[model samples]
Target: MPIDPQAARLLAMLGAARPTDWPGVSAAARRDGFAALMRMAGTPPAVASVSDVRIAGAAGPLPARLYAPRDGTAPGLVYFHGGGLVAGDLDTHDALCRALAAGSDCRVLSVGYRLAPEHPFPAAAEDAVAAAGDALGRAAEFGLDPARVAVGGDSAGGTLATLAAGALRTRVALQLLLCPALDAAPDTESRRLFARGHLLDAAMMARDLADCAPGALDLADPRLSPLRDPDLAGRPPALIHTAEFDPLRDEGALYAERLAAAGVPVRHRCHPGMIHHFYGLTGLVPAARAALADIAAELGARLAMG
Candidate 1:
């Protein structure tokens, strides 16, 4: 299927201003640039309330933002933003968090994990585990039931969410992944099919993998690539969302298959004619909005199961 019309237009617009040499720019500049672009694409949807707080991290206090619905004491979701583990922060994903909180009627805690090249591999993963633990540990203070908490994110953040889920196991009710880059090895057919023209190209992904795992760290390590984990039997139920036109599409599908094979409940959906990062484009694309609503419904249902 061809890309959705609105999505195609977005791709064209992004291509027109896309950076030619990402490695040449400083990480801070790239972070700022990405945030500005997201802001220009659409205005954030309003929520009942948003507050900033710090959570205990492996390295230090991790800055986080909380989005609460109008009602009191709802389920909680620990969210991480996507930027290949190199860019993105709490501000970059503020709008998406607000939308999720409003749509799912759940409190969302968006964690600002340490980035790569500076903190390197396992640093972000460690911070993710710590933040999730903290969220569950302090669920009452956040007006959430500890047993109803879930962890989720998009792209690289999705990878982190999976790692956190594996580490926390049944403690987390569900795992929500959107266009997740689960495998460090890009040998899948989708990687070749959508390698260049799509918003996420092969070259950029390679750079991101290298930055996150500098030196001789094995890319196949389960901490670095959750799909490589030897055991997925005890992991939480999963709702995996993938894009038909995304390079990581096959891997996300494969991960779902693995989970199901390991006896874990899995709900996987591949959005036709969609590309990576479409979940955040809810304001500009009709498909994205629909997808967001579907995700919210699923999250709400699964969390309510307890």
Candidate 2:
């Protein structure tokens, strides 16, 4: 099927607005570029009644924004935003986080872990794991049910969410992955089919991997590439979403396959007419809103299960 008209328009808009020289810019410049992208893409930050707090991590403090639902303290999700692990923060994802909180009837903790290039490879990964630990460790303080905690993210954030699920090993109630770039190496059919003009270009992927990895990351390391994990045992249930026109689509689908093969209960969806980062385009994309609703329904059901 052809791409949705909205997706086509979005792609054209993105092409028109893309920076002329992003590949040669400083990390800070790259960060600013993504911030602008978020602004161009959707609604501004919602009134997050949720307070901001810093969690203790191995590398210092990891900042997080807490969004409590209208129902009060409930199950919660630790949501990481996608910016190639080099950009994006809580501010960029605040609207989506608030929507998730309201729709899922769960507290949403928007994690602001350190980005790469400056932090590099395992730094962001480690901080994510630590933040999950910190969240679980202080569940009572946050007024959340420890048994109902889940991990969720989009793109790079989704990859981290999955890694956190695997690392936590039953500590997380569920995993929500939205078009996650699970494999850094581009070897899948989706990577070939949707390599360009889908919001996530192959060149951008290469640039991000190069910046984030530097010399410390082995692309095949299971920590960096969850698809490389030989064992997916003991992980929690997961809901993984994929966009048909995303280079990362197959990796997300394949990871779901691997999870199911390992006996993890999984629900996977491939939106055939959508593109990468569609989940964050809820303001302008109808499919994006539906996707968010699906996630909210799933998370609400799972949270109620406990």
36 in model 1: Cα distance from truth in Å?
3.1
Residue 79 lDDT in model 1? 94
lDDT tens digits, residues 116-216, model 2? 88888888888888888889999888868999999999999988898889889778999999898898775888899877777888877778888899875
Among residues 3 or more apart in sequence or in different chains, the pairs in candidate 2 whose N, CA or C atoms overlap within 3 Å are none
What is the lDDT of every predicted structure here?
0.87, 0.84
Model 2 residue 146 lDDT score:
95
Report clash pairs, candidate 1.
none
Residue 296 lDDT, candidate 2, scale 0-100: 77
**lDDT for each residue of candidate 1 in 188-268, tens digit (9 for 90 to 100):** 999999888799988778777778887888889987788999999989999999999999999999999999999999999
Which residue segments of model 1 deviate by more than 4 Å? none
Candidate 2 overall lDDT versus native: 0.84
Worst 10 residues of 2 by lDDT: 39-48
